[model samples]
Target chain A: MKASEISVGQTFEKVVVEDLKRTQLVMYSGASGDYNPLHTDDLYCKEAAGYPGVFAHGMLTMGMTGTLVTDLFGAENVRKYGVRFTNQVWPGDTLTATATVQDIRDEDGRPVAEIGIETVNQDGKTVVLGSATGLLED
Target chain B: MSDEKTVTFPVEGTHVMMFARSIGDYNPAYHDPGKGEGNPVGAQVAPPTFPQAVAQFDPEYPLRIKDGEAWFGSGGSPSGIEGKPATSGGLHAEQHFEYTRPVRPGDVLTARYSQGETWEKESRRAGKLTFTERLVDYYDQDGNHVCRARGVGVRTERPVDQG
Candidate 1:
């Protein structure tokens, strides 16, 4: 659906937590060429890196949020998407993403909606947060 | 040894678009001019991964490590190891970014990056390995904090035992 059809202050359906994991991290790392040890090395991450276990890459987590936004607003309609990492996501952390319409504006008198997107872990801690802006179809 | 130095650069609309294109994300927000907000005011809105596109550090920085260096340089060969080649022989591995606010056109952005952490380990598939982490911070034209991203990179090489 076009972004124009959606109302302001709307929230999107959250994705399942099972979709988050190490394999996804590995794939993203390979695709993005960011092979950091903290995301992949369990032992090193635990012993030297100072974590309970291996953690997912922050970008992988952010990508998951991006996927959520794209799914809701249609990839073509999204104009701006950005995020900030708040906490580390370890393997097996359950995550759900949500977006709320923040504002709708017109650029050169064109209609656009600004939306806020966030990913929160099972503990209710926000792992990723950002805002996006998109032009509604006329 | 001293901590790895980090450098930051202002964000440019062209650079952001280049990053989005390089990642194959062609969303209208990232590409078309009249599609969203109808403002040819600036480049397309950057993709989620756009911040990583700028070369935040010297390419040769990671290669300057000693043998058996424990963290960054010790995994194997002097030239470093290889697994799946990156878009440019570098993988994304992992990234963490926090956006204090959205980046808009005319907002000059700057990215500062520092070497965060590094280590070595054995992988059953990729064999000996070295890993490095980089932390990046982004700020807008007003110098207001925009976003910060931390990325990890793994370099694989043949183990010395194999030689």
Candidate 2:
């Protein structure tokens, strides 16, 4: 959290989700108001849409992956955060997110930490890749 | 791609708490009503991607299953809309957020949406990807700029090849 304490290449990791559930996707749909059936409706995904089954929303994975940034810098300390959803995350998949320090520098007179982030599924396939810049406490 | 729309989003503690839970973040600072008083932000704040939840407030949001109108998701059958393709709905490709300040409960914010960029790409898994960027700027009730969210949505020509 403190600019002085963090060094480049330091990594922080957390298992964001284990055995991803359709119910969690439903909760996300209700919470975020995205009712895309590709996320919550299995029959629709399999029968109508032609996918294997229901999949997690891209935002859901991004939201889950955000725990790394929020846990490290605090939600309010985030100056900029972004991500690219790389792979589809399906039910029963486990996701682990890692954030590695990329730089510690000053921007506009404020100490900032630039961090690279990646979230991978159980098979080690990258589900999301992105970066964030957070304001340091110092 | 040149259309603009605006919606009013009133940040609520309960909504923030639920959103955090959906993301599996149980940090008391995001949910506990008075637990965040000691935080540097001085109040309970929404998660970094919480701005996307503004879809709940959009009157014409196409994602939500509205009453009287036929819904896309299943009820009695696989899909209410006949012959709807699985790849019909667009997918979120990228999202970026820049904050002037964290969103706090009780903050009534205005979200103005504007089109950004459009491009095309080809992928082995999905053919002919059309990507569009949309930008939303949030301003507090006092007219102070609070945050900006840039999102890229991609539409595939067909269902993504799983193999």
Candidate 3:
């Protein structure tokens, strides 16, 4: 949707990732080179780190959240993006990412849209919370 | 960490595509540069969180979580707090990204990595929490500020039987 078309407080469609799998985390680790044992090696996590099992990488979830904005605004138009990892994400957990338009205004001669981003897990717990802004084309 | 250092990443189309793939993002702009022809940064733009992944290439990365170098009680922590080993892993608390220009393939970018802000907080599970915030400012080959990134990680102790 165009920046002009988006209304303040208007929330876009939610992107839901269901039953998040371990393979996805492994692939992300290989791709991002963030092979922290907490995200892999269940035995190590249970013995050394003292967690139930592996958890998703915060960047992986943040990147997943970014998909919400970039889907509508495109990656290049995203001028600012941010998030706070509020809760842990484990395998089999479902996450939903949403972006609500906070303001649609003109910056200089171009339109800019500020959005509030949030991702919640199945239990209605916020896994990641943050905001973002994108430049809108005329 | 040290004061500051220059970190660079050699951009490649395959890596960009791989990043998009990793996130299961099927955006054409990331795979088919032709879709982004009219955009200012050219086609095949990097995803918004692409720089976070590229941080591994930096030899001077402050917290090597994967290496287990900065684990709690390791004394390698920025806070220099000493304590018994913690059972739980560290957490990535927050992140921020600001961009001046969209990154594209063939664009050589350099980032200055430095510490932002840090503090201590008492926690129930962990004795005390040391939160370290890191920053990276990206510059293009032409020396134009392309983007900036800030990240925060927290270390603390946790119960062994968190099960």
Give the chain B TM-score for each candidate.
0.60, 0.94, 0.74
List runs of model 1 lying over 4 Å from the truth: A1-4, A16-19, B1-163
Q: Among all windows of ten consecutive residues in candidate 1 chain B, which has the lowest summed lDDT? A: B82-91
What's model 1's lDDT at B90? 33
- Candidate 1 falls in which docking quality class? incorrect
**Candidate 3 lDDT, tens digit per residue, B1-163?**
5658887788788888888777778777888877753355556898898887666687744334535454431222312224424444468889899989788888888888888889999876556778999998888888999899999988875642332
Worst 10 residues of 2 chain A by lDDT: A41-50
Q: What is the TM-score of chain A alone in each candidate?
A: 0.88, 0.98, 0.96
The TM-score-based order of candidates, best leading, equals: 2, 3, 1
Q: For each candidate in turn, give its C-alpha RMSD to the true structure in angstroms.
A: 11.1, 1.4, 4.9
Q: Give every collision pair in model 2.
A: A49-B86
Q: DockQ rank, highest first?
A: 2, 3, 1
Report clash pairs, candidate 3: A49-B87
Better of 1 and 2 by DockQ: 2
Off by over 4 Å in 2: B1-3
DockQ of 3: 0.53
Error of 1 at B85 (Å): 28
Error of 1 at A99 (Å): 0.5
Deviation (Å) of A42 in candidate 1: 1.1
Q: What is the per-residue lDDT of model 2 for residues B55-107, given as tens digits with 9 covering 90 to 100?
A: 99999999997879888888899889987766869999999999999899999
Q: The CA-based lDDT of model 2 is what?
A: 0.91
